[model samples]
Target: MFTGLIDKLKGKRTAAVKTPEIMGLRLGASFELDPLAIRLILDELTIESCSPTQIIRAAGLVELDGTWVYRFYTDDDAWLQVVAEGGQTDEHVVDVKLFHFYDTLDVAGQQAWDRLLQREIGAASYSLRERTYGRVWTSAGDYHNPVHMAEKTYDGDGEHSLTDQFTMLFERPLSDQRTESLFLSAEEKQEQAGYLSRSLVISTGITLTPSQLTIHG
Candidate 1:
């Protein structure tokens, strides 16, 4: 079944991507790609068209666990990760980790994470906190730390839904502020800001597509 997904993808001719090298699955070699490339592969595999059941039922979960546990970063320094465990389908559980670049876990925060794991906090709940350096302020003139928050969770291994886990890891809320931040130039940022300011948050792919969103200027 795992080989079938690879064969299907390999059979499709994507001009620039060179599907055979996606993981060298043809040879039964383990993942040898870097974090970004792996993230891109996961992003493609977990799409709506791909059956999550097939993925979970196959050896894919083992690959995901063995290879993807390390942190993966975005261009802006934000990072995310996923780890799967258990041998049986019903026993399978996945842990997702996301970290915004600005938020660094302190010694106490690290201990808290360790305790959270020790206690096996359930999936329905999470802990979030703002990091600060005393009364330090940023050059942006907003609150010193601003209202930005990083999201990283450590949940206990147990019975879980892989589909639900996929959604949580891939889909993200879209808003004007986030759209505005995407712009690199001042003019572009100002242009998108007006449009995003009038829009409401919606669940959409982080890449931004017109199909799932309609922002007004």
Candidate 2:
């Protein structure tokens, strides 16, 4: 899939597979393309590939086991297609499967399979934090570090003063929707951001919504 410059430069391709249960399919060698490119391609595909009878509802990338995958859904939020990287051959055919139910496994077997999948997929969540401290004043006008305040003060007035308190909130909401890959890498993030920005500019005459954002991603 990555062999050709035109194909690689084009980045990814998504198609709707005609099947009973599955409504869509996406194909790509990497989620390494600019996000704007992904969004633009998706927008085009949404209109071009969908039929009057079947509406393209949602589409985006997914990451499983460190590899990026592509996904598409229908208006009913039904699984349409799930394609993984490294599965395409020289013919450019994707190793995608129409949505199908796996054979029901017994409780013990299901548990084992779940554990194995988790090991490969890593944790389902991530968090990060940082801390720093320096000379600062309290609401009562007392300095946090007297020695530092003294060293930096002149005529009992400090070079730096903390007159107000500030706080920041962080939260990660649980998503009923699925996540594509681990957050796109730093480079990929920049690319995707740029792409979306450009798309918004071009689509200025159109009303954008959360659904548009989903398609953009």
lDDT of each candidate versus the true structure? 0.25, 0.25
Per TM-score, the best of the predicted structures is: 1
Error of 1 at 86 (Å): 17
Q: Which stretches of candidate 2 lie over 4 Å from their true place?
A: 1-53, 64-67, 87-93, 100-217
Model 1: clashing residue pairs? Answer: none
Model 1: per-residue Cα lDDT at residue 179: 16
Count backbone clashes in candidate 1.
0
- Per-residue lDDT of 204 in model 1: 15
Candidate 1 stretches greater than 4 Å from native: 1-75, 79-102, 108-113, 120-123, 127-217
RMSD of every candidate to native, in Å, equals: 20.5, 25.0
User: What lDDT does candidate 2 reach at residue 65?
Assistant: 50
The true-structure Cα RMSD of candidate 1 reads 20.5
Q: Estimate each model's TM-score.
A: 0.21, 0.21
